[model samples]
Target: MSSRFVFSIMTLLMTLISTSSAQAITLRGEIQPDRYTYYLTDQYAQKLWAMNRDRNRTIRFNLPPGELVAQTDVSFAYQHPAPTAITCISSIYYNQGARANWLKVACIDNNGLEYSTHQKWPDTSIAKRVCKVGEASCDAFLTMSSDNWSGPQ
Candidate 1:
């Protein structure tokens, strides 16, 4: 084999090796109008990984140390009382006794999305979740059906 050809092959091999050894992780998660869950993976290239349900989709992600953010969608149906209130929550844990903060958006009776803060901290301090919102807890409003909530109507 020619010297130039041999050198090129070595360069390509080194590049591939470096890329594969990088420290990054992929994450997946799933969120319904009323529930959600997520998990992190081993770091791949200085990044953590997470995956969710439904989206059944995976994403390659990177975040600054001590910083985290997640986004997802949900669907819900109206009840007899109408103007139903829907509250959804999910939890996360890092170390055995690490503190983790959580933030989530809830979709209620198709009135649109509303954000809620973490009401109760889990026993582990690492896990974060939300409380339930019901008819009595939420104020009265118009109920939006699936069709009415979709597209230009």
Candidate 2:
């Protein structure tokens, strides 16, 4: 093979590898009605396994309240504690309606610990709170409350 042809092949291979590795994996799933339990698709599980191989600490992502739906994509942020370290979710709530009606959502960690946020109309800012890290696995969903809305207003 010509030297130039060999160089071109190596460059192409390198580019392919870099491109594939740079792509991030996103996990999609739904928070079941059970509220505390969540189900992840097989693809999500596989992707999580691949991503977790390089990590030593458990990771959690604070998904936006709007994104909690029948099906949602869950992606981890760059900021995470060691897989074994303690961490929690900080939430902020704002009033999303004009009436006295309010909505509160809670995220439950693997250990049954719950972090909640309350929002009333006109208060668009998220309420903030943190729950100490619990088990190795974590999941979150909206809890049914007087202020909870069946859907986005």
Candidate 3:
């Protein structure tokens, strides 16, 4: 039991398993655009004024591959009457070792109930990212919100 205390407990269990496998685990959540729904392409009726009764909002997300740092904050509100055109779009799909990449961002609403913030940095090779209500075919039930996205660190 004494070989220098078993080599200092095997070097402190291999430095706590390599510092907890090089620490970095963060994933978040918070999405509400009328509980998900997406399908639009009517060429945006009159620039999307609630697209005929909030055609169902949508957002999907998945990430696993490597390096990812993203942030998004979207807030929308509308009373619709040909103003308050909310458009929030975020799409990022990726693969690097075999070459594949797609990145898109559209957070529009230059006036009326607005709050849009989007960011992406440290993209070592993403894998998933999808948000909706762009091109406006629907999603105008307004009061939309978003926040869940940390990364595939």
How much does each candidate deviate from the true structure in C-alpha RMSD? 18.1, 17.0, 17.3
Per-residue accuracy of model 2 over 1-153 as CA lDDT, tens digit each: 999999999999999977752332121232123222334344433333344333443334454443221111123322222121112222233334544443544443232222333331111122222222232453333323532556766
List the lowest-lDDT window of 10 residues for candidate 1.
Answer: 44-53
Model 3 stretches with alpha carbons more than 4 Å out: 1-47, 52-55, 58-76, 83-99, 112-153
Report the lDDT of model 1 for residue 140. 25
Candidate 3 lDDT tens digits, 21-84: 2322221233323221122233332334443234353343454322121122122233434333
lDDT of the candidates, in the order given: 0.31, 0.34, 0.35
lDDT of 1 by residue, 1-153 (tens): 999999999999999987752321221233223332111122310121221122343333443332332223322111122212322343332323344433323322223323222323122222232233333333322232441566675
Ranked candidates (lDDT, high to low): 3, 2, 1
Q: Which stretches of candidate 2 lie over 4 Å from their true place?
A: 1-35, 43-66, 69-97, 109-153
| Among all candidates shown, the one with the greatest lDDT | 3
RMSD of 1: 18.1
Model 3 Cα RMSD, 1 decimal: 17.3
- The candidate, 2 or 3, that scores higher on TM-score is 3
lDDT value, residue 82 of candidate 2: 17
Clashes in candidate 2: how many?
16
* For model 3, the run of ten residues with the poorest summed lDDT: 66-75
